[model samples]
Target: METRELRYFVAVAEELHFGRAAQRLGIAQPPLSRAIQQLERRLGVKLLERTNRTVTLTEAGSVLLREGRAALDAVDAAERRTRRAALAATGQPGLVLVTKAGASSELLSKLLDAYAAEPGAVTVDVHLCGIGEQERLLRDGRADVALLHRPFDSTVGFDTEDLRTEGQVAVLPAGHPLARRAGLRMDDVTALPDLPLPRWPGPDGTYPDGPGPQVRDHTQLLQLVGLGRAAAVLPDSCRAHLNADLAAVPVLDAPTVTTVIAWPPHSRSRALAGLVRAATLL
Candidate 1:
């Protein structure tokens, strides 16, 4: 389907009302409705169920909404990357590498230093983001490469090279009872009544139903731990950055986190390749 048709369908599916979707798209309702109808006819399936007062997605429409969003994102990213490429050709060349804030600092430092020493290295701009945002940045072409942790960050559509695999630790207030433990099991941490694990926002920036403080980044979570308001499970490497008010005890069974350098599969930029090479080398 055309990108215009996909956009019309996505807008309608999201709003569930042609009037609102048309308003959002800066078009008339009739044209929007007609476009969706033509799209459904060409695709040979009912994409939506429309009654007098409400509209809902059919199973096929649900699938298209998901796939259509990705397709549009890919198209947007391509346009952005192409424009950035032209800018690079005109002498503003650089690679933007993104990762979670306060994570893998030592590894990132070393990787930057190593890449800077390469023969034709360009400027590497490091973008420190909040939890689970690196994938989106990379996918949207705002970033050339990203340092992603597996099982926490999705790496489904990228080319990646595993960098470091480390165990996890439960971070708690220094004065908390669990802070004195030599190590902890997953159950021990999960069952803590006074220090529940902090809730992190998903990709949609909404926290799941939970009885923990909502947090956006490691800095906030660590501050919460320091204040004795919550607990957190993070990569063992985090121990190096812990302050005196907080403590990290190894969580014996927490799944290991593997840090990987990820980039789009379609990227052919030599500088991005150099950055990925530098990351894997470290």
Candidate 2:
């Protein structure tokens, strides 16, 4: 049962001579012989056949020797691996964060600051990448964790946490007709004279900015409205951070874009949990 006993038994079993096995083990021949005797007695098996001039292994001794060597090798490997893991977790390691290239960059900046504020030796490496790249990195195990927008492909196998909700708002040109309305409903804006709401892509199937109003990236579409070129409705949160020149009205009747923190299924990491917690705080 003791590792020492196993070691002594194997030494003598392989060498078939206690004196030689003791030399190999850097121990006295008497102790090595006694260890083998105790091991065989505990197992209730005759392991060795000793003669005046020759020594030989019994059937049981041969089998135990083969399996004992394998057990010792496995124990050595497990100990080495455990030490390596301890070093990785507490010594020095970087937490990987992959995210979409939009507002997520701002969100990560805030999280990184919070995570770094903790005491002790800990730090993070942020990987700010495109939406497609973030998804790919998470899928391929290159990322330890990530923060992303929801309504992603379910097939990507991601989990999400709702960070914040940004509702629809309307942007209007500085001098455009209907600019005076406290808040123009989508229907009201449509009815205004030269409402100039960018024409959502018609059946031609292109996008509004792309050729669909729905598909316009925040920066470009917001630009058009910021210049007073047209009125736009976007998430209230996005508008909340905009320049004084641009204004947004909530579309009480429209769908809202909710920002969520997403990651692959079954993903578990302490650094990730901290980041997720920090994101909601901001």
Candidate 3:
């Protein structure tokens, strides 16, 4: 019911282990367990199922986890917006724009130049983040806007405008058999027994179960591909950075990636509006 209770519930629900959740929350395990028990009692439902060796979420817990996460995000957004407002009242420099690192370099350069040329434009602070992080930065007011690639990044809670769309390419080691082809389909790349698709970390920083190596960003993924450890389906723009050791072949059947300018739905800053306008014009 309260923010503290929700925070505790989320931490425990995510970890599924009271001791680890307590450690993450910087509190003792018993207290964390008690808080969850109290929460369950107040809600009149079992949120977690616990035994000697394992802990798992109940159906109610699964529902609560999803709703509670959104509630917490709202709370965080409120606090962050208030702080940003206070800072702006004191004439803080400008808005922050976040984008995934090593993505859309050419488009970003053009967007920045266009926005800067506009009259009354404020100083823009660009924050380069890792994959799957742009949404959090926007939701929590750490960023005013983001350039997100659709199908890869979720745009569920934000307003967005399409900037560009391009097909995907499979980045493979130069000497790999598939790399010699002029173009290929998704099956050609995904079926490679030796070079599995790299698994990217979720927002929680845990890598999904897979045979391929886990990678955090484009640089790491490219390096892995060059070493023949992994293959990646990436935006076509990524070919600009590939070295001779790597080769990119068009993945004819892969879904096209659209780069969009996204922002929190409730944002009201004129500077943010101006930036969006400039970006759309590009």
- Which structure among the candidates has the greatest lDDT? 1
lDDT tens digits by residue: candidate 3, 1-282: 999999999999999888899999999998888999999999999999999989999999999999999999889989988898788779884889999888999999999999999998988999888878887898877888999999988899899999999999999999988889999999888899999998888977799998999877888888888888999999999988999999999999999999999998888888899999999899
lDDT of 2: 0.64
Report every candidate's CA lDDT.
0.93, 0.64, 0.91
**What are the per-model numbers of colliding residue pairs?**
0, 12, 0
For each candidate, give its TM-score against the true structure: 0.97, 0.49, 0.87
Candidates 1 and 2: which is better by lDDT? 1
Once fitted onto the true fold, the runs of candidate 1 whose alpha carbons sit more than 4 angstroms away are none
**Regarding lDDT, does 2 or 3 come out ahead?**
3
Residues 135-252 of candidate 1: C-alpha lDDT, one tens digit per residue: 8999998999999998899999899999999999999999988889999999999899989998988998889998899998898899999998899999999988999999999999
Stretches > 4 Å off in candidate 3: 11-42, 46-57
Q: What TM-score does candidate 1 get on C-alpha atoms? A: 0.97
- lDDT by residue (tens digit), candidate 2, 1-282: 887888888888888888899999999988787788888899999999999877898899899998998677656645644553465578655566776544444556666787677544245666766334665555555665666554432334567777766556676655555555566567876555544566543323455453223423456666777665556665565644577666565566656666676655654555566666666677
Ranking under lDDT, best-scoring first?
1, 3, 2
Residue 54 of model 2 has an lDDT of 78
